[model samples]
Target: MPDLRLDTTDLERAATGLDAVARALAGTDTLAGDGAGDLGHDGAAAALRRFAESSTRRRDELGRAVEEFAGHLRECVSTFDGTERSLAEGLGGAA
Candidate 1:
């Protein structure tokens, strides 16, 4: 269904955004313990913290999007099952 396609697309986009956030977090971690002086350390720590927060938020958003997409998929399966049952019953009655 079109709705399912749209939901899938949205889920993919959210996943991609989360991946980018993860990459940024990894880059920040590389800056740690490099002994770049007090000011440099502070700046790197701040940047790392910001990246961590962004990653957390993006991960949360991705999780919610996955939940929504799964719900939609379940609904679609249930709908198809119901339709198949109804069609089978109709054919049985005719036979």
Candidate 2:
């Protein structure tokens, strides 16, 4: 089988980008609506509150998942780079 080459730099960059996305998602508290009274209708305001709450919950969950995935990607990059370095060193010593 052909050797599989991974660009660790690109992987790390992607993880960084995901971290930014997760941060943005984490800042969705504005969706919860602290002053829904200005909406001028009781039923509609309540419904909007419910929808906002649900959306905020889902966004928070998604943010956590994305952060976890980014962490995993960083770990993979570290492992791959370490293994490559060890292999190269071992080969040099054998020479």
Cα RMSD of predicted structure 1: 7.7
Q: Against the hidden true structure, what lDDT does model 1 obtain?
A: 0.57
Q: Per-residue lDDT of 1-95 in model 2, one digit per residue for the tens? A: 99989999999999999999999998767544666667899988898788888888899999999999999999999999888888888888421
Listing every candidate in turn, what is its Cα RMSD in Å to the true structure after a full C-alpha superposition? 7.7, 2.4
lDDT of 1 by residue, 1-94 (tens): 4542234455456656655655554444323333334445677767766765676666566666656665665566566666666878888842
Q: Rate the local accuracy (lDDT) of all candidates.
A: 0.57, 0.87
Model 2 scores a C-alpha lDDT of 0.87
Candidate 2 Cα RMSD (Å): 2.4
Query: Which ranges in model 2 have alpha carbons more than 4 Å from their true place?
Result: 93-95
Best-fitting candidate, measured by lDDT? 2
Clashes per candidate (backbone, < 3 Å): 0, 0
